[model samples]
Target: MDMKFKRNFCIVAHIDHGKSTLSDRLIQKSNIIDERKMKNQILDNMDIERERGITIKSQAVTIPYHAKDGNDYELNFVDTPGHVDFSYEVSRAIASCEGALLLIDASQGVESQTVSNMYMALEQDLTIVPVINKIDLPSADIPAVREQITNELGLDDSQTQLVSAKTGEGVDGLLEAVVNYFPAPQGDVDAPAQALIFDCHYDPYRGVVVHVRVKNGRIKTGGIIRMMSSGIDYKVEQIGIFKIDYEPTGCLEAGDVGYIIAGIKTVSDVRVGDTITNADNPAAEPLAGFKEVKPVVYSSIYPMDSNDYEELKSSLEKLKLNDASLVYEKDNSIALGNGFRCGFLGLLHLEIIQERLERDYDQAIIFTAPSVRYRVHLTDGSETFVDNPAEYPQGRIQSAEEPYIKASIITPATYLGSLMELCKMKRGEQTNMTYLDEKRVELTYEMPLAEVLFDFYDKLKSFSRGYASFDYEVIGYRPTQLVKVDILLNSKPVDALSFLSFKDNATDRARKVCERLKDEISRQQFKVAIQGAIGGQIIARETVSAVRKDVLAKCYGGDITRKRKLLEKQKEGKKRMKMFGDVELPQSAFLAVLKDNEAD
Candidate 1:
């Protein structure tokens, strides 16, 4: 029996492109996982992913198959992050496998990101196994899709496979393709053990649960290991290999992937792309191609109450245990009091965490507008983080810079003109374009990451009528005119509403932001003034609707009905009002300015 070698693969698709449903069907048909309990994106492993139907992180599982040749084979599969913010982790996932299962919705066909992901797979020298998923849908066009994969992704007829990840159709053929087409690992078992830690998460008791791909080595429970990159050494407390059901695999050798539970317990202890090796004779260097993710979005997260400061800190620490990409530091927020300024890969990733904190932790969070990190050039010749516009010495700042990204999109040909208008509006510099098929086109542009984060997807959906998908990767940072936009409430600065913006858009952006705040904030028991000011000049102003019925006019001698209403009103007043001199400022006044909409 020639050792049957099957290529490990992962399904990569854009959000709403049906990656999870397809994976669910694949696992279900193998009888490796029960469908009744099978939730969408079971591999997501996070409550957030289940609710959103998006895979924010990558996951791995194994399903055995009986090949057409009547041979036994194991298909080790991984599911990866589709969003660019998680690209750092996604790159590692791509490296762990020999091929990818690129799922495309039959009706939507090839999306903007589908081509990008396929190209990344090619860069890794991984074989492309294109999948036309959701074929069972009423809208699915099977023939046109096969052409797009071959033309856009450069896949041959042999590489294209269509399947409905929903109905479990064509999945067996997809399994067969993986075994027949993809090449197995070419390695010597006797060579030095060198595995790569593609990704890891903090697992309280176990510390860091390092996800490793054995490039070369043998590992087992109780074996001592060292993170060759971090110089951190620990004895393997447990070795668990992934199946539909995880169990003690006893050991993992060269070309296999599994989790290593070492005594080392910290996120900082295991980094993506780091090499793991035997402790006694460690590999001297980490693998090349490890790129540290640069956070492009910044915002302040504060608790509604000043007393919740400690609670917020503990909450962030917990979030950081799993998300090492997040960076934060203690800071002051005038509106919400003490808080921390946090860095995120992008805005979507930032909003997701804030929502998770509120939903999962049941804590109300006061969030500031997202701002991209700015590079400032001082007259004295120095570079500094101009995060807080308040800290910026306007006259002294000679020049400023912000990060930029290379964005690409795939959509129906009908959306080409509409999306092009949007791209131009976002300062998107046209790079190139390719037609995926007669009905679909792939558009490429270079855009400022800041502009992309400020509701690029929302705009894309509206213009394209929800037919297009968006993706972007940071190309590099460049010098640009950046300014800080500040908000004032009754002439007093509200720190949480302040953010960074392009100088050209400042006045108009300020006006729009002020308008949004005015709309979201219901009028308090007192009139509140909202102003958008640049230095001494006020560009826009809006006032909260007056509280006409707040004054007690019909009460005499504390009449029973009036007295009851008065008592309840008094409690409510105390809950929301803060007094300074003769005037009372409603807590609602502070909250009214924290609107979700970004100003134009």
Candidate 2:
């Protein structure tokens, strides 16, 4: 394969902007998949991705296309998820390519994710090809969308490709432009092996399979290789490229994308963003562009059944092979039992992982409310990062700093008032606002990461009538009035029900949490008091009344004296039981509190 004839690029857009549909069209144009076997979202291999109509994981494939230029070109397509949570995957995909195809909805114009991804592609120095999708829709305002792309994103209108990914219209021109516009991969084939491992997954029978883009050298089936990051050596078991399925190739050359099976037993052995070089003739230095993924949001994940603890642990380890953004530590809770405190890039990343555990690994799990990492300063003049609210130090906290983010939202002009007001409620400071045109607006704000973690995205959707798009990047930490609120049932505090909250909203949050618990917790023999407190100062409380039975129900036409005797006996029994017996709350009660909407 000639390096000059290879075109490697990724398709990036906001969620539901026709990314997967466009990928299917590309595959069909290349004749990679039979038309009969083809289906919607073929690139999304997971059931959840199809059901949700969103790409969860990034997929890479090699296709052979005969362009209008009368030359055969090998196109390596990396399809990425559109949600903000998977932006890390988008970054990795951009690093592997020399160009990108930026897609935008014809009716919706430029959204927040589209802007975010376009800038990322620019940061990677990739040549971008702007494309307008869903042009066939009745609501598609092609003229307005083209103006948006040109004005807001600063792209030439003539350079944008218009297409309907669902109907396969105007895709031919898009293909020709890809091969003619994007530069081919440039690398020294004679140089020693230096490949960048962008993704990997664990195979139960064959070990860890790594997906890599050969940056500067060649790798063969029998050669010995070492991971530059870990310094672990292994004899390459197999080499292959994806063409609908893995087709073994004898060797992989520079500028080529493929996979390698290296008898790796666990994910810890191989790390994403790590470079691979020949063990015998290693390069002088590893390839550039390696950034470690740091999780921003964290929550406690535990097995619904204690016996599934090991299963959950093993499942997480296996899933971590491909998902390097997940971070976890052993955590124990008096209420939820043994669990792991897991960190994720964002909320969607957190949700996808938990779903995979239950659906793919068959392990029922429980999750606490998600929280952001907090920087804690002690009176002893030291700083620490706290991920769990239950572990926050009391009385020793000199000052608390919460993480902040630069958030961007794109919505219609009519929503400007409601959007800004909502941001203000989240403690957001206005940064800037740009009008894309007469109808669309882009608003930027500086807000706390904790404020956007929960209910913010939901509110954005509601305020804009499901037309707003949001993206956020963590800035630094700022001093804030923060407190750890705990929920108590029957005078005992549940660790899993504890959470960090803003002091101003503490009262409302506490009241809602107690109310949710009151509705979820069963009636006890004695009146159960549900209290929400911060350092022993009760802010909110609720009471669950005892379950009183009809002691005289069995009395049929019996004398009043007999009914009174029975009632007296029942009352005595209840008093004795209430004094000696313990109130045993069910697992659902704890789960209900953890899942409480206002807990955060």
Candidate 3:
């Protein structure tokens, strides 16, 4: 293979600016992933990501691309998560690449976080390739967007590539940019075997499939490669690069992005950013890099069917194969019995993970509202975890400090007022504001991570009429007045669904959550009681009345299937309820919206 063809680059963009969709188009054009199997955003590789149209999980694909000069070279495509919760992961992702293809939606050019991410890439000294995507949109102003990228991102004219992911327009120019500009891998080929584990996953049969970029020398299959940081060694079983799926091949040489299979059954064996060296003669030092991922949100995840506890454990173990930052612990409660406490990078990260757990594992899970990590100080000078505010007793909290982020919002001037108002309501203080161009304002605010992760985002967008986009990075922890709001169904408290909010916002938030729960339960075939309270004060309550039509619609004698289905539906309804003799109230229920605007 020629030394010049390989360009390791990541695709970065603001949330909903078409990063994942653009990635799908790139995969289709490169023919790396089989078109039939290549679902939109194939690199997301997670069902939650697919449903949300966001890249919660990052993945890589190596494909061949052609230049305008009629030459071909392999381009390793690393798709990155767009949210700030996964920013640390994003940094590690870009470190493995030489450059990035920055996708900017033409109508919404150079968002706040877009600049921040591109700046991170700049700090890493990676080449910048600006791509103005969604140019096919009627509102697209390609020339203005290009100018914004040039001025704000500090990239050259040659660096900007325009493409419409939906229409497959100008994608060839993107490929050309990859080959012409992004430099090949730079490393010492003669040095003793050394590789950086960028990402990895555990396969029950094949062991751990670690995604590594060879920094020096060569690594062959069947050889013993020891992770220098942990001093753990594994026997290599397979070495390859993913071309749609994993394609096993020869030894991985320096500068090549590839995968290695080690006889390790767990994801914990191959940590990200670990240095890999041959067991015979290893490197003196480990790959001393990457900041640790600290989760800002904690949630309880338990099987809706309590019998699926073992299956839930297996499912989470499998999920952790590639997602190591996700922290889970078995939690037993007097109310919910047994469940797992899961930590996530942020609120979106928690939602995405929970969504994938249900979809991929085919198990229903009761996921609690996300809570921020809290710092508790005891009189005895011994500290303990109190992620859930409900765990803290009244007057017991000497001082409570919650995590906050410096959030940046980029939207049209029309949305400026609404966004600022939204920020203020969330206890955010404006830091700076800049105009990237006419009508486009970049407003920065210092707000609690907890504040933004709540319905603050939804309200912001709704107020701005869905034109506002937000990104937040953790600034530091700050002391504040917070309270735990618990939701009780009937007289019993639902331990898993409680939330913490500022004293001011607790009542309204509890009211809204309980009402939403009521509306959701009203559609179920059985009765449910929904209530929200703070301390002993009941703020809101609603009931999902029992289905009057639940009686047999038509009894067909001797029709075993219909009888069985009727019994199944009744049994299911029975299971969904907390039987109060005759009145039943479900812990939760799901309702699908119909065009008729009527309940099912």
Per-model TM-score on C-alpha atoms: 0.86, 0.95, 0.83
lDDT of 2: 0.88
Q: Pairing residues by index, what is the TM-score of model 2?
A: 0.95
Better-scoring candidate (lDDT), 1 or 3: 3
Every model: Cα RMSD to truth: 6.0, 2.5, 8.7
Best by TM-score: 2
Per-residue lDDT of 490-592 in model 2, one digit per residue for the tens? 6678888888988998888889889888888778776788999998899999998888888878889868999999989988987787677676767787667
Instruction: Name the better of 1 and 3 by TM-score.
Output: 1
Model 2 vs truth, CA RMSD: 2.5
Clashing pairs in 2: none
What C-alpha lDDT do the candidate models reach, one value each? 0.75, 0.88, 0.76
Would you list the rank order by lDDT, best first? 2, 3, 1
- lDDT by residue (tens digit), candidate 3, 1-600: 655667788988777788777778878887765556866666766656666677766788888777677777788878887776777667888878898888888987877668878988998898888888898899999888878877877788666788888888988777877888889988777789888888887666787788988878888888998988778888888898988689998688788888998778765666788889999878777665666677777877777678888999988888876686888888866555678888888766776676678777787877666678866665666655578655776556666677788888888898888788878978888999999778788888998877766577667778888787777778887877777777776557766567677778777776666666666554444556677777788877777676655445587466788877887878776655645333233555412211111110
Model 3 CA RMSD to the hidden true structure, in angstroms: 8.7
Q: Rank the candidates by TM-score, best first.
A: 2, 1, 3
> Native-vs-model 1 lDDT?
0.75
